[model samples]
Target: MMSKLLKNRYLILRRIVQITILALYFGANAYGWKVLVGNLSYSKFLQAIPLADPFTVLQMLAAGAVVGVDVLVGAVVIAVFYGLIGGRAFCSWVCPINMVTDLANWLRRKLKIDRDARRINISRRFRYWALGTLLVVSFVVGAAAYEFVNPIGFFVRGLLFSIGFGWTLILAIFLFDLLILKHGWCGYICPVGATYSLIGSKSLIRVEHNHLNCTNCGNCKEVCPEKQVLNPVIYRKSGFINGIECTNCGRCIEVCNDNALKFSIRSFLKNN
Candidate 1:
């Protein structure tokens, strides 16, 4: 019963987030309210949020003497609040990219095709290779190489572009999701996911698996989008799961019929 309730809540949250993203896309483009918030140019907003282009923060970090304390603080706060709150919960729940990914997964499931690419027999090292390439390109070329692959950008372009072109692009993503890869764009391609995973390693909030209650029925493994829960290393851990790849989607917890899973937070400093 509890598991069902959590699943329902997840579905509700997913729909609400998708609706919000669609509204924001149309609202920002149609009404220009995004401009009102920060006087930020469209290109500037894209640069700041997704592309991380121009590498302003990296440049600041490189200049070790006079660091931008304000920027650092803002970045830290966002990372902790979002990243540390159960890995990639922000991505799966709030990110515009995730909305599109969910759509892709749905299309794939409808077609009876594998939606995730990670199921392929490629070495896990491929993720590292992709990450390296994205970082090098971002730094060297001063271009948002990963932005072109970003689902958020794709969704934005889909909404703002000509209807024919926009729908075409969306359809292409849907087809790719159905035919080519499961979470192909998200798991291996998304630089944002990679970045979040790195910062979220230290996250206080995480999933806890109760081995005593867990029957090892593998429901969580079967339902996991990222398949991180099934890894031998994670399965061996006690109580809270600390895998960096965990997205905190709560799917595992939601599906655990035995109520063997939960979310927990650990404090860094003990009270005196």
Candidate 2:
């Protein structure tokens, strides 16, 4: 049991963080706890410091809304924070929908459903296109388009408020990831994720690969959500996994038996 816990520490920590964020949001809504108020799209820290999702702000801008100064500052704070660490860290560490998709992925592995699975061929780049389309729609429709149907919003708000279509949408995401494709929603469809990936493209914290220690067991890639990010560095050369899509979730590091992969500060001095 101790060994298992140690092995899955990062996963455990991620769950804790995700749940705690939700709990804080729920508490703020229900009991007026002001530590962290508001939803993921726009949150107020300690009721003074604002933290807005930069992408949501962009959608508002596209819709030609008069965004407030506080919201703009909040967006900058979030963008800079993620830019220093990693952007999609929001996907793994904070987003409520990640729990649903991760559960689907876990079930796929346990049931051996992923083995020899004939998966759909959705390009990961589709997320960028989706992001572009959403902005266009926001511009045309004069509203933040994705906000109406965002699964993350549904999952979070549904939990805080009354149940409606949110639960159904959340369930569909789970099923889509489980049966339709692997890493489908966040990888291929989420514009919010695409925006974050772009923001953290040159993040300081990154997973560094020491190929000399790699035994080629393939455990890291097997567990990585974005396995493509591992391809250029794993067994190829000792370098940073510099892909913008990497969530820095530490799954590869946790699963690797040879200690070939670990987190390190990215060196901007070198071209890596």
| Shift in Å, residue 216, candidate 2 | 0.4
Worst 10 residues of 2 by lDDT: 263-272
lDDT of 2 by residue, 43-150 (tens): 999989999998899999999999899999999999999987665699899988888999998888888887778868879999999999999999999999999888
Ten-residue region with minimum lDDT total, candidate 1: 35-44
TM-score of 1: 0.72
* lDDT score, candidate 2, position 51: 96
Estimate, for each residue in 225-258, the C-alpha lDDT of model 1 and write its tens digit.
6785446433454466666777777777777788
TM-scores for candidates 1 onward, in order: 0.72, 0.97
